[model samples]
Target: MALILHDVTFEMVPTEVRLLTAMTPAGFPSPAQDDMEEPIDLASWLIDHPAASYVMRVSGHSMVGAGVADGDMVVVSRAVEARSGDIVVALVHGDRTMKRLRRRGDRMWLVPEAEGLPAIIVDEDVEIWGVVVALARRYRT
Candidate 1:
């Protein structure tokens, strides 16, 4: 399962979010105010380097504890160097997998956040695709 990065570029269409001046509490229903701030570009805020970033849909519950849920879209940076404790997409023996990178001395480990799953020890041949920078989720379709 080799995941290849397709050479693709597109115009950045930013989603504008309404900035509220006051914090609305979910526990208590408060009267909505008409106070409006400048619209913020979520694409600019989420992506630091758009040229090096790509989005992919996640699968399975391997990374639930790390805030990455199934069907969530994750922003991955191919140009970013993956470090220890960073969640990354990697090719382990031709199989693409998402896991947290862990390093101890000369050994590397791909750790899963879900319980009952075993961590994988990195072999001699491994290709790290990118580091997961941000996650996007939808509450309702």
Candidate 2:
């Protein structure tokens, strides 16, 4: 799938949201808390090196096994060096794609997390664009 990238623009003043001190449990019911912690700046918390990061909306199921789904937004960071096993946004033969980066000795490959998808051997035509820093998803409109 072709990657659709959106530039991240931050406001001059950061927006702070109230943060709860309690951690919500996923497996069992937990006691709720009325306590409020210090407000958090989501943009700062989510995006490290804001000047070198951008957001891209995912458009394929190739990364479903990695917990990244179609329609999710991933924050890509160019400031971070792409490493082996890193989920990266890359330009493959001039086409952009998001995949897991794998390295074996001197060779590298772009591997998909889903079944039946072919892994692409990294060649001179491929360029690692950025490393995936964070993911964002909305359950409802």
Candidate 3:
């Protein structure tokens, strides 16, 4: 599966959303709390460097195993250095793709999360564009 790249632009005004102080549990139900925290700017919370950060939409199932499903939006940050085991947006022969970065000794590779997909050995033609910092998804649109 291939990924499509898109540039994201942020508005001048930040949109604040109310954040609950209580932590929701995934395994069991917790007591309901009425505590309300300060409003949070999602864009600011997700992006560390606004000038070098971009949001791209996932178009394929290659990263589904990594919790990045199709149609999900990922925040990419160019300010951070790409490290081994980090999910990154890469340009392979000028084509953009999203994959996990792996470093074995001096060799680097781009690995897909899905089965049957071959891992790409990083060479001169491949460029690590940015590292995935955050993921956003909506259950209903």
- The candidate that wins on lDDT is 3
Q: Give the candidate number with the greatest TM-score.
A: 3
User: Lowest summed lDDT over 10 consecutive residues: which window, candidate 3?
Assistant: 25-34
Query: Candidate 1 — worst ten consecutive residues by lDDT sum?
Result: 1-10
Residue 129 of model 2 has an lDDT of: 92
**lDDT of candidate 2 at residue 100, scale 0 to 100:** 93
All-Cα superposition RMSD per candidate: 4.5, 3.2, 2.6
lDDT of 3 at 112: 88
In the range 22-89, model 2's lDDT, one tens digit per residue, is: 65556443456547779998877888677788877887677887888878888999999999999998
Q: What local lDDT score does residue 90 receive in model 1, on the 0 to 100 scale?
A: 83
Better model by TM-score: candidate 1 vs candidate 2: 2
How well does candidate 3 score on lDDT at residue 97? 89
The order by descending TM-score is 3, 2, 1
Worst lDDT 10-window in candidate 2: 3-12
lDDT rank order: 3, 2, 1
Better of 1 and 3 by TM-score: 3
Candidate 3 off by > 4 Å: 24-33
Report lDDT per candidate: 0.77, 0.82, 0.85
Residue 99 lDDT (model 2) = 88
